[model samples]
Target: MDTAAADGTAAGNTTGGRPGRGRGRITSIEVLCAVLLLALLGQSWLRSTLDVPALRTGATVFVAVCVQALPFLVLGVLISGAIAAFVPARVLRKVLPRKENAAVGVAGIAGVALPGCECASVPVARRLIGQGVAPAAALTFLLAAPAVNPVVMVATAVAFPGEPGMVAARFAGSLATAMTMGWLWARWGKLDWIAERALRRLPEVEPGSRWRAFTETARADLVEAGGFLVLGALISAALGVLVPAEVFGVLGEQIVLGVLVMAVLAVVLALCSEADAFVAASLTAVPLLPKLVFLVVGPAVDVKLFALQAGTFGRSFALRFAPVTFAVAVVCAVLAGLVFLGGAR
Candidate 1:
């Protein structure tokens, strides 16, 4: 009611009448994290103490996933910083579409230029869309940036060992999924709701001052993008520990199961597109088609990716859009699998 009370309310102090809702909001987040951690610990202890092999198996899966991808998380952030600093936003925007379909194609091409994990792509894509990029193009970049980068290609090659075809499948599969998802979203989804889709002109700094701009942009981007990348890795790790691997094996053999595996990996790995190929290749236990699905889906969707979409667009957009993308991506992966990777080698 009063000025002091209003300030208190904003500060999240409930005791003071009219406490700040904003301040309370931050505190609530911390409290939620603490509660989750405690629950995880309790479940972990109970599962271990009970000597249940299945329970321990879930925890192992969660931890393995998180730890396996932590390095890539850091790498993605560092690379993102460089893009923010040295690369002009306008340069990226210029490459995107004046039309919807072109926008998606441009976004996919743009993905090769900026190498980062799924989480890192969120901010970069947001900046492009916020600046003047079309929704179709931004979505394309959002799906492709993680999957099509050079770093990821090398990783795929290495992970597949003797199989060059594996690398090819990953690249082609990812490309197909990115392009298809973009066109689909533009055609059927609620394009009107995407806040970042309509980017305007990016602010221009003088050419002479480019070095200074690079340094400043890189610093801020590393902090923002890198932080989220770590958060994503942690979520993936938790999922890995909680789910059993063998369960994913049988399903991976079937066309439907392969899609489902990809969908789940999209949620579990939370990896950058550039790095996910290697991870997918290493999964020799799963069918080739399923691994391809994993590669395609990870870049398009993940828990952290959803969190970012919610923040940038709105909860409603993320809630509906992620599932839609998941379904579409699975279907695309299935089609790709059938065409190329359907039969076992």
Candidate 2:
């Protein structure tokens, strides 16, 4: 009687466990099916909604900008990777001046060599700082690389057509902004504001494996910077459509208003430095000074650049650096414009 009762109890337990296990499997399958259905519905909704003219234009512009900028960004990352893999940190330190101020000047001048957009410069600058290069110098490179590079200068000349002076003015204004900011930081910037981990050099790879290191570094930077580039392009394309073209038509003789407007536009648009010159040239109602300001401020301090800086240098540093760079860039651009483009046409 006891054996029969025990066997019956075991049978009851087994029967109860099976349904619970089956219910769990059924629930999981239902959830996965629901997710797949939702995704399909969302995709269909997006296709219908994005058929409007404004959105279509925005999408086209976004694609064009991304296509235009990707090659330059890839090249910049490759150079950065080469520098990381081939150049020892000690070699960089030896090349840069020991004095922070002198190093800052050199760094600003060195910007002429790198010919990529602001997206490419942030990681390279962070790497420089990590290699024990002075923060001030690294910051200067961050500002100057996108602004004063030969590619940007050439593009400015091409965009402006007859104006050789625009190229000269852009170069001067950008360099001045970068150098001035570097000096300011050298005098009063606190070291603690930078993330501690960002300051340390990366672990050295084996000498024989440098080629592998180069490819890996380049690939990583390309992936990271490419994401930000796409985002910035989207933002620019959206603003291009949403902001009325007629708004720029009314600023006839308002020099101060134009400068302020252009500066604000520069920050909001966050156009690539290489491409911003063409956009500025297209704004026929805007004065040369304002256009110059747009070119300078866009490269040195804009929405995208601010995001990049904050991500790399920590929020505290970016908060301080971006505002100061913006103000300096605006002032330098105005001064350079007055000298080069003049107050008139």
**lDDT for position 321 in model 2:** 87
RMSD of 1: 7.4
Query: What lDDT does candidate 1 reach at residue 145?
Result: 79
lDDT (Cα, tens digit) per residue for candidate 1, span 1-345: 699888876676546445345443557678899999997879978656877665565455444544554555456656765665567667887766588887787778777777755665676667776677766677777778778787777666665677676667766777777887788877876755665433334455567877676566555655554454455545544444554577656665565766675669667656656446545544545677777777777777877788889887777778877887777677776666666654543
Cα-based TM-score, every candidate: 0.66, 0.71
lDDT of 2 by residue, 38-76 (tens): 878798787887779999988877777676666556666
Top-lDDT structure, candidate number: 2
- Superposition error at 238 for model 1 (Å): 10
Shift of residue 233 alpha carbon in model 1, Å: 9.3
Evaluated at residue 186, the lDDT of candidate 2 is: 98
